[model samples]
Target chain A: MRELLERKLVFVTGKGGVGKSTIAASLALLAAQQGKRTLVGEIDAKGNLADFFETGPTAFKERELAPNLWGMSMDTEESLKEYLSLQLKIPLLAKVGVLARTFDFVANAAPGVKEILTVGKFLWEVREGHYDLVVVDAVASGHITGQLAAPQAIQELVQVGMVRDQTDWMIEILGDHDQTGAVIVAAPEEMPVNETLELAARLREETVVELAAVVANRVLPELFGRGEEEVFEALAADDRTPSPADLLGAAVGGPVRPILDGAQLAVTLRRTRGVHLARLRDELPTGTPLLYVPYLFQRSHGARATRQVAEHLAEELGY
Target chain B: MAARQRTASAGSVEQLLAAKEIVIHCGSGGVGKTTTAAAVAAMAAVHLGGKVLVLTVDPAKRLANALGLEAFGNVETQVPRQAFLDAGAEPRGELWAAMLDTKESWDDLVRRHAPDAGTRDAILANPLYKNITGRFVQSHDYIAMERLYEIHASGRFDLIVVDTPPTRNAIDFLEAPERMADFFSSRLLRWLTVPARSRVLSMASKPFYSVADRILGSKFLEDIAEFFLLFQTMYKGFVIRAEAVARTLADHRTTFVVVSTLESAPVREAEFFIDALDDRGLHLGAVVLNKVLPPWFLDEGTTATAKAMVADAVSLAKVLPEELGSPDQVGRVLREVGESFLNFQVVANREAEMRAELSAAPEVVASVPYFDHDITDLAGLLQLGEQIWR
Candidate 1:
């Protein structure tokens, strides 16, 4: 908690199916619980954060999801509207609206402008100082590099204007090592690990933002001692043992042996996951913390699941 | 016409593969595109009796799992071929699958397509080219398309099924090869080259020029200059190649099957992709809606009543939401629950409507229902095949 509070903005990104929104929400909840005003922002155009908050998609504007915890799923055009109205002092529905729409159309037509606007909105919120911490649930690792570099990319393309000024300010905020931190979330798989390392390297090269941590989600918990492998083998080989089919009767209980066999399978899965974690740690830049999240059987979508993930993160962050 | 042969609800994908050399599957993320693509390729190999290769740009391991392979690198592996043999089939057709690695594939393409050894090395070593090809745009889809083109040209398979990247990137990738070829031939590139050469030619600061020369070799710069010197010739060849690919993609021998789940976003994405294909003169062969929720289940109240009377109450918490107590809260919960059910029904109904709309244009081959387990392995894939093939 102390470490997380030390940074102004926290960027959490991971592979697509790795529960990034869950982690970001949990972090926001943790921060708010510590009495810090925290905001969890999601830039996914699909508006998933509201769903995570048990709200409708229409409930996307800034709203208090929990005590001291605000949530907003960014709509690029809406954010642009808000930015123009508030920051630029443009009228809400004036001629500027038409111009803003035109700008949005042009930006949307450009390759990476949506990403730029999304990230730019985060930068805008950080500058407002309305929250003690801002946790951005960024896109998947595959597109995150472009998302992070978007301000600079757009700044280079559009020179000598208010847009450039905003981009410059964003670049400064993002490039400040003490102000921002980036966490790469991944699963214990070859492709995700490879992409995580690549993302870490890019962040190190392009920005001063600290590559603070890597959260490896859905890791199978290691159970049983090394010798349990042989024990399981011996159990399977026992000649006098009743067949699993015999044990499947009402008297013996339903599917106990199959569940036990599944536990045995889990052991191998855990071992494989551990090996990948070790390899990722070895390959990652030294001093970058690696956090492993055990796979919970339940779906990690609601408040209960977010709390569970927060507990894991709390332990990892040494809160 | 190609449109005449396609079915609105084409019963099976078998006919679609008959004449098509390539089938591109496009959909939103989490829609089982990988599984559907794998199933189509598997069907081609096992049922259609044609050699097939499934190419995927999904960073997820779904493709490898669907094919029952332990892992898939950039290179094609021969696992499905073995699966067919094990199924008591003759294995007359071979199945191969590969995961696209964008940067590596880009490097390979540059090396293969460059005019000369000097130009190849120059482009490989140029930081600008490296940035442009490697990290400039979303490279996953572009590389996937390039790999598809390579596989098509190799003549190793009679049919190729490409599981496209998610919607946005897939669109970008489909257009990238032509875009990149055009950029290589554009006047803007010619303008950037003059500045690139000045650092090499200017002898006023010999040491700085030498350093620049070393980084981008003087000889390499000269070759790049010469290559662009004959830019028209190179551009003509690239345009010709692109045209050939475009024509091949539009031919009756190719099909575009848009995969979606029986969900709102996916259906919308599929509709958009179908329209885009039509606008581009591409033909739609099938629409495979996967992982659809079952239309009906045993009523919970009846099951609860039975269990309660028998002195063994069945736990409904796992299968049903908990009673939230207050009527309003329950109403809210029900409303939320109702929305999901409504959305599912809406998607299913809309799919039927879409099929009817597309009936005049092409056949709707199959609609796969949602399964209890994740489609993560060959066994699951075989299960998927059973559902679709019938």
Candidate 2:
């Protein structure tokens, strides 16, 4: 747990719909439970994170969802205004009225402004030291590279100024491997895994951030061994024979053939579960610590589910 | 034997190029839009003897890798000069490629086209303008339009092939330049500039002035004033340029090549994009259905058991129309899978259907079968070109 606290930022990213936000929220919860002031930020325009906290969309302005844990969905416009004021030292009063309105229009009109503002906001929060840990549920894979490079892009575009100064600070924070780590979350499918690997390669090529670990979510648990095969064979044999009325009580026989039919079904289910689990283990990155979250029967939304996930992560993170 | 089905007439890549000033290739993600765009440009250059430029907005950098170029930047790099020259014809025709750097290009546009230095400085200095234009604006679309304008203005390339982002993003990118230009030119923005303009005329008491001064701190207020003034001057030029590109896009030579896969979603997205093109009055060159699965699965005897199983399943359900049966069910599934391969002939034979409905538009020019291996290099583009032009 102390080793986990060594890093200031944890970026949980993966293919779209691969439970990234859930993992990010869980990590933040885990950190906060350890008494670290943690903040989880979501850059998705859909604002799905609010649902994770059992809150409404309007409840987005970094309210504490749990003890020592605050959450925010990146509000591009508001964050842009704050960034402008703080970095440029623009007086707060002067930032409003006509000037602010014009700024809003211009910001909305600018290319990559939404992405830059979103990333810039995240970078700002990271540099501000307002929290011991900040977890960003960044935009999906399609735009993540661009999102990650927003600060650098802004730095180059603005070139020598307060904007550049902020950019410099962000680069330093991100480049520090001990302070920043990225977790690539993926499912046990071909397309998402391929995309995740590609993303991992790209992140390695582009950023100095280290790959912490890969979280393979909703993995099926291994439930059977080779010993279950005999049960299936006995079930097959029972299907060929007529049901004996006294066979149910004669389970102590030498053959040990069960008169009950559901035993084979149980064995089959166990075997199928084992095969899927084995395949998942085989496909996952070897030697890299893999955290397998069991498939939830209920939708894993809201605080309760998030807490359950956090518990799983706590065990995986060796807490 | 099955009726000898004709392969859809793939309109010569050259013919399409000859016709459009701006040819936009659009499709769903992972359906080979980038490679197809490259092939079209390559074909237009090598076979047609015309200069061609292919612009890609895919952040994956696959386009650059496809052309064997080191990297895709805002500037156009000659394709033949890159490592993938073997893919082109001997005495290769001129092919240019550029990658869109949305933010930088937007800044460059602001600096280059702003009405005056004061206005430029003010707009650049204003944090709002800086953030909006730099980050929020759909840089890809603007840069694509800007790149087109630059290339079109340069008269260096006879045809420009633009590979739009995957279907959803492609539509957004195409609509972005106009949307962004309109946002900057809106009445709301004009009204927002009033305070900065009236600053000199207002002369109340010291406290009142101080309050107003605090509200519109002279520096920030002046920067906003400068942004509007400069924006006004640049707006007209930007609008005209966008319109010119739009007009070029609308021109007969500017063909909208809607690419798609055999998959239902990609096909559906392609259909939607075609509708969008029609809505914009953009010329539909042809639909190039890529990665189409072949229909031989039904004709083969080895798959007979599976076909029979499907038929039995269909018959037992009794949900299918009476005209559909065991062999027919197999054929229908095969047809659905291989629909892209047959789409061109189907569409051509039913021209009246296209005319009857607005959505039923565009002629199918070619159908390229799905490749066995992933298209990660120039060789893949060549293979795609062979299939497209065959």
Candidate 1 per-residue C-alpha lDDT over A1-319 given as tens digits, one digit per residue, 9 for 90 to 100: 2265567798998765556777788888888888889888987655667655675553347888889989987787777677667655644467556545644643433444567678877777788898888999887776677778877765554444455556768888888767788988887765567678888988877755678678888776555444434433433333543532232223223322332333344454567667767789899988777887776644224678677888888888788
Candidate 2's TM-score:
0.55
Positional deviation of residue A57's Cα in model 2 after best superposition, in angstroms? 14
How is the predicted docking of candidate 2 categorized under the CAPRI scheme?
Answer: incorrect
Please list the residue runs of candidate 1 whose C-alpha ends up more than 4 Å from where it truly belongs after superposition.
A58-60, A86-93, A109-113, A155-159, A223-257, B1-21, B26-51, B58-157, B167-390
> How far does residue A283 in candidate 2 sit from its true spot (Å)?
17
Per-residue lDDT for A1-319 in model 2, tens only? Answer: 2244458887788865467778888888889999999988987654567777776663347887788989887776677556556544556556444454554664454333455667667666777788889888876666677667766665544433344455667778777777887777776543456677777777877666666667777553332233433322332343323422123123222121221222233334335444544554565455545677754433225678788888888888778
Q: Which candidate number would show the highest TM-score if scored against the true structure?
A: 1
In Å, residue A85's CA in model 2 sits off its true spot by 20
lDDT of 1 at A196: 82
